[model samples]
Target: MTQPPPPPPNQPPDPQGGFGAPTPQQPEPGYGYPQQQQQQQQPTEPGYGYPQGAPPVPQPPVPPQQPPYGYPTQPQQPQQPQQYGYPAQPQQPQPYGGYQQPQQPPYGYPTQPQQPPYGYPTQPQQPYGGYQQPALTPSAPGGGKLSAQLQIVIAAVVAVAVIIGVGIWYAGSGGDGKDDEAKGTGGTTQGATGGGGNGAGGIGGGGKEKPPANTQAKMAFQVPQPKVPDVTDVSGSWITDKAYVKPGVNSIVAYDLDKGTPLWTLPLTGQVCGASRHVSADNKVPILFEATKRVAPRYYQQCTEIGLVDLNTGKLVWSTSITGGSAGDQKARFSEVTLSGTTVAAGGTDGGAAFDLANGNPRWKPQVNDENCYDMGYGGGAGLVAVRKCGPYSSQYVLVQNLNPTTGAPVSQYKMPTGVKYASVVSTKPLVVAADVGETAGDGSGISDFFSLDEKTGKLKAKITADADQYAARCRSTRVEACSQALVGNGRLYVPTEEHEGSSGEYGDETNEVIAFDLTTGRTVPEKADAGDKYTLVPLRMDGGNLIAYKAPPYDKGGQIVSIDGGTMKSTVLLENPADKSVRDAETSFSLNGAELAYEGGRFFLSETLVSKAREGDDRNYLIVSFAAGH
Candidate 1:
């Protein structure tokens, strides 16, 4: 390759004058020989570099020392180079955008040189629409070897940064593919699972837990409606045929006891169905419900008909539409109703009265001065027991009255202590046991007080308190967990009350519970209904014992059902779901023969199948399980 011509005799070739600034003029070219360029001479003054006569140009800041590249860097001087070998002469000052003619150099150097702007590349002269960017070149250092080392270092740093960034991103992405898969399948790799997974797609995550297997031979009954059911009575296995159904405004339906299926659906005819209360003394008769109906056109209409159905067949044994004088008057109501054998007794709003079972015939009617009488009880042998309250809807005391069931004649009357609100007769032969409400002073907690009465006269014989601490002392020989284990038995009552301090530091108070009471001595003892203890099964009832109780299995925070022994009283862990907090109601009872025990709760039925045989042994315990078909 031919080398480029050298600079002219009077010119210098350095292009490092901070770029973009004007340079001295170029020299003329020679034929066959290298052209020459005229160079501006540096003035002798300090911090100045320019020829004797030239246009002024701005210079860079005063550097600490002269830069290594020998180039003009002065700002104030106006010096210009003369033609080669020629004497200095005055010349016209050039305008900012004007160019001067080239002058010949005295000796060896190229002419017509150009300088580039600071941090910019020089461009070839071409006709174009706009500026074209120069190709980018890698930056180089002062020395060749050092520049190569710097390049190597930068490449390494960049590589390392990219690697680190990728690693951080991967870590922050959370679960791996396998983890996600596991979550999708409810934390398992099982096939076709539906629900939130353990990681991302858990099978049971968002899906509801699988219900327990239903294995009972007898099918369990369902509420006629899936909403809050109006529970009337537990009369002989929950028969739900239409005959037993009370027409409700919402088309209410009850369930059948044997098949656990919905019974008859009665068109409520736009009236709210009432709930049944309890079973009669014979255990075969059920005291069903009665409510008034409000017909349309007028805002209110008096209800006259009372329905009495056979427990077994749901057959309408009797229905009586009572007639009160006025249409809007509510006093034409059948306030309370009950049954004895084939006879149905009803208390009317006008006065106390009883009706016949075979037909809507009045058996007897009695006079009651008080208008707002609420509840009535009966003793065997055709005598009436009523609870009468006084004051503006405030029940201060309970009035116990006995009337002739056949004639509805007043027999006798007695008043209980203050604050006696609710009462139920436990027996009615020679002696009668009744439950009444009482409240203590400390927490004003209400207690169920049991009382024994003389059947011959309407008189209170004895009162018993179901003190928890007292029952706990009696059961000290055995494992005692809670005070509520006491239960009432034939002609006797059992109850347990505990004195516990309030968790809020308001002073520990006892829960005075009344499970049962003894009529003869007026003493209360804890029976087995109190299963609130941590985990200790207390037998709720024994065979042939009037009182029976059972505890449902303990579950985790979640309400997954599980099987638990009624007698074990031991706590076991079941499904735990912290999100749901619902109160569970459990009822335990002995089989009709008392050979086995059963428990009922929300969609759960538990039974001790071998309890009768087991009770013969010292163990007296049997496996408890959820009833498969009956639940």
Candidate 2:
């Protein structure tokens, strides 16, 4: 899946005209009381009668040096007669109400120069009262009085502004009284729209409610890692060989998943089969093992024997015969065998066949063309057998067939990719089935592919290709093919791949990794180790859906066990083994229901490595994990 895009940058702020506050208008000219009085006097100068720019002329020179007698002195006596005698000539009375008037000279001033009173104008007074306050006329722009029409216009604008402001306030506040009446079912104002309205079903007013608690269920089997044993050839499933144990021999010993456990100093019985054969389908019954009487080149006589002691009573159960080949045949060997329900199905060097649980009756037989159909597994509601067929001419045929456990009928068969056929079945699921795929016959240098097959049909599902042959070279020089890459689990399939050499020139002897693939979906989880990382894999029995994958430390034999809880799709490391000891690489592993049962390092081991919570009592703790169906 593609990744999502990044987010955008933060938005810029919006602009508002100015600061959004009211501005003070320039004060109207001459508006204040004292300032208006000064304005009224400005008009008076305009109405005054004085002529602009008029200059005064000198009158006839008065007789200066006049004596107190009102006559000129004798030194200026020549002009004194005209000046002193002229004043007494006539004190004529003025026509208007004048107290003393100068001689009315017709040529000197106006002939009828009758003046008004001292502070009045020269003209006779009219009937109108004083000045009439100049009728308050409109003035110019400099220092003018307001006209009547302008005053009316200003008043109308103020009224309109007030009306507009009131209308805006009303609209913003939800349309005034009409809205209030329409929404006043409860006779009160509300802050938000439809706020505190009746809720669904009209039960109570709406408001916030709390979230509910988590109530989901989950699966509980989380498998812890298994303890390492002190042995090599640790491959395939574990078995107790209870079907062939002698009466006087030791019993009930614990061992690791790989090797047979030690009872005091005695070796476990029937553990050294020619093909290393062991089979147990029902956990309730004793384990069945194939004990070849002679070596591979000699007489090939085999028997399917049972332990002398029972699991519950410690008593010997009846031994059953597992007939394989003609007494003269030497190449015949028991490859894979398992008990399904009450019937037992065994695959061998010649062909595949079935046996009855009650009396060992021959059910059916089918031939295998593969030369190396050497391994068998039973779990996923069916039984499977891995084969290496040698076909016509020189073809190396490799295949695995699903068989009817009761009748040995070939239900399904799978043919893996060419040149990638020598493999061991690791684990299978509904969607993806996995197996170890590579050239395991001799010293090879090619890549290994982990094949996943569909459980329903025997078709190829997916492939996880890696280099297992290179990894097995360094794991140990004594390792065999069966014990090389043994891996199995429920949700996971473990495929061991070799790690490539780095620039450090440090060949850590053995560098291997267990590749885990999700079986539900045919995908490799991202949690897998980096390519060429080294590790080992040990698959415990399926408990339910959840399983465990144990991870060993890098460059060290000792490691820790990790429980993989399937429902959560996660793994947690649980047990940490001691660092001093090297792990015993065994080939066998088994599970009784959810528990792991094995025998390695000289003891029989049974452990409930991962158990569910639903079955959690001391009495119910033991689970009989079997890879078989009911009778």
lDDT of each: 0.29, 0.30
* Count: clashes, candidate 1: 73
Model 2, 395-471: lDDT tens per residue? Answer: 34344444445544334445544332234444333323222222332323222334445444454433433333323
> Taking the tens digit of each residue's C-alpha lDDT, what string does model 1 give over 1-631?
0111222222323121210111111331111221121133222211111133443332222212211111222233454542211111111111000111122221111223222211111344222212234533347566344477776786567545543322110000000001100000000011111111111221111212222343222223322212212222111222222222322333334444344444655443333322223344422232323344443344243333456545445455555544222222333343344554444544432433356655658554332222233223333322345443322343233444444454443344444443344344433343343332332211211223344555444334444432212332121000001112333334344333332221222221111222333343342212223333221223332222322333322222112222221222122322211212222211122221121233322233332211112222332121222222223
lDDT of 1 at 471: 30
Q: With candidate 2 superimposed using the best TM-score fit, by how many Å does residue 109's alpha carbon deviate from the native?
A: 99
Q: What TM-scores do the predictions have? A: 0.41, 0.40
Worst 10 residues of 2 by lDDT: 175-184
